[model samples]
Target: MTAVVQAEGLTKYYGRRRGLEDLTLDIQPGEIFGYLGPNGAGKTTTIRLLLDVIRPTRGRVQVLGGDPRDPAVRARIGYLPGELALEGHERARDYLRFLGRVRGGVPASRIEELAERFEADLSVQMGKLSKGNKQKVGLIQAFMHEPEFLILDEPTGGLDPLVQHEFLAMLREVRRSGRTVLMSSHVLAEVESVSDRVGIVRGGRLVAVENVAALREKAVRRMELHFDAPVPAADFEGLAGVRDVRVEGAGVRCTIDGRPDALIKAAARHTVVHMVSAEPDLEEIFLTYYSDEEQHSARQESA
Candidate 1:
């Protein structure tokens, strides 16, 4: 199957400063590809490059099997930018109606369906709507036409927990229909929940791309346990895959790499009162991969 989005040596720069450098990636069709990165890490830069909003300093990209600059190709795409600007006195519904017409005539019923689903009050003027409400409008416009591909930047920002859940459901529905979505988000849970695969970007470079399940298997987890009675720190410090062991008073804290079976078994020796395990997130995953890369480089140098 042809990739829905492809980039080769995609690099961008602003004067002498680098925006994104040598980003090579393929987003397969009918899948939700999550783009993960911290701020100033080039997630938005890559999106703009794909949308042809700004020309790349060097490199090439294709969206939907054709050049993104092609109007016909662009028409098949739905994009929701991170910084959405809504102004003027036009009612939200009227603004959507206009956008629908621009995107080749989306039915009023379709618009209404989305509005109802998001519980968005479209009767209000665009300028008067709250941030969350404006985001709802942005989402409605992006999905109203039902394009073949969608590129969303920080798609769930400003949404309540319930609305965010509903939006993720909508993404699953889109996938079921064989459409594709590329979502760039800072929320790791959002990405981990729906993405089939995730691409990690760091410092303007494409660092690692891995299957979500595989990444989860090796993710770093920080665990804290509070015991009714203080336990010896030596028990946890020697456990495999556990590090940064610190025992203070009746609580023990440590970082565990990959599985925690060994730590759990060791901790069973003492009476456990309270235990909190921090699930690995994008930053943790990136740090793990980055550390691995550094170790490999050091080994090569020693050789």
Candidate 2:
């Protein structure tokens, strides 16, 4: 199947500053792909290129099997921009109504349905709405069309916890219908929960793409154990998939990658008084890229 979104050597620049640099990626149809990065890492720039809001400086982009600039192709896609801007004096409902009409006379019922689903109060003025409410309006507009492909950037930026959870459930519903979603977020836990696969971008380049399950497999689970007495050093030695062991008085800590069975078995051999294990840090993969970049820059400066 053709990818929902495809780009080759995608690049963007704002005069002297590089917004994106020679990025290439593909998002499979019906997959919820998460795009993750920190501020100014070109997440928004990539989204704009996909939506044809701005042309790339080099390389090609295809969305929904056609050029992103084609009006017919855009109709089949829904996009929520990273920065949402609405002028003063317009009620939220009226604004969504205008968008609905622009998108080929979409039914008002769809708009109302989304408003209720998001728990958005549409009577409020656009300028007066709180940041969270404004974000809700943006989300409603994006989902109201019910397009085949949905691309959302920093979608939960201003949402409260409760609303954020509701939004995630709606995304799951979207996926259940076999539609595609590309969600860009910096929040690891949120993205990890909903995404089938994730692409980590740093310094305007794609670093890694992995399925959620595979990522978890490589994740390092931290465990700390307190024994009634100091355990023998040989007891924990040669444990499979365990590393970075540090043992203090009556306590031991280690990072276990892959399965935790070996580590658990090793700990069980001792007189265990207390034990704690933390879920793997999903963001560690992204941090690896940052660290590599820093080291490379340091080498260049030293030279």
Candidate 3:
């Protein structure tokens, strides 16, 4: 299947500063592709390039199999920018109506339905709405048209937890309807909940892309085991996937990668009294990629 969005050697620069560097990626149709990065990690830069809001300094990008500059292409896409700009005095209903007309008349029923779902008050003027309410309005506009593709940047910003939950449910429905979504966020848990595949970016570079499940599999866990008696450190050594093994007076602590079957069995040999395991957050997993890259660079320099 052709990609919904594609970028090859996609680089962007603002004067002498780098915005994004050689980001090569493909987002498939009918999947929620999470673009994960920190605040200045080029997620917005990539989005703007894809939307033709800014031209890339180098490389090429294709959205919906054509140039992003084309009117028809824009019409088929829904975008909710990270920083929304709303006309302060305009009524929310009037604003959505204007956009609907621009998109060739999104049905009134559809607009009403979306508002109801998001619990958005179209009656309020844009300026008077709270940040969370404004976010709801933004979401209603982006989804009311039901375009073939959606590009959302920090979509859940300022949203209450309940509303955020509702939005994620809406995304699942979009997938079920065969539409594609590109969701960029700094929140790891949000992306992990909805994204089929995630692209991790750091320092204006694409660090890694992997299936969400696979990425979770690579997550590190800190494990501590207490034994009835002191256990020898040598007994835990040479266990596959275990690292930083330390034995300290009836207690053992180590970090484990992937499954803990071997570690569990090894611990069972001793009189296991208690165990405490803590799962690291996705950010830690993401940092491993950067760590590996740094190690590689250092090795090259040494060589």
Task: Tell me, by lDDT, which candidate is best.
Answer: 3
Q: Give the least accurate 10-residue stretch of model 3, judged by summed lDDT.
A: 279-288
lDDT computed for candidate 2: 0.88
Where is the poorest 10-residue window by lDDT in model 2? 281-290
Best by TM-score: 2
**Each candidate's clash count:** 0, 0, 0
- Cα error, residue 176 of model 3, in Å, equals 2.8
Candidate 2 — which pairs collide? none
Write model 3 residue lDDT over 100-129, tens digit each, in one string: 999999888888899888889998998898
Question: Candidate 2: lDDT of 4?
Answer: 93
Model 2's TM-score against the true structure: 0.88
Better of 2 and 3 by TM-score: 2
For model 1 the local lDDT of residue 170 reads 98
Name the runs in model 3 displaced over 4 angstroms. 224-239, 242-254, 263-277, 294-303
**TM, every model:** 0.79, 0.88, 0.84
- How do the residues 1-303 of candidate 2 rate in per-residue lDDT, one tens digit apiece? 999988999999988789899888889888999998877888999999998888999998899899999998999888888989976898999999998888887798888888888889999999999899989998998898898999999999999998898999999999999899999987777799899998877778777788988888888788999999988777777889989888887899998888989888888878889989897788776577669877987899999
lDDT of each: 0.90, 0.88, 0.91
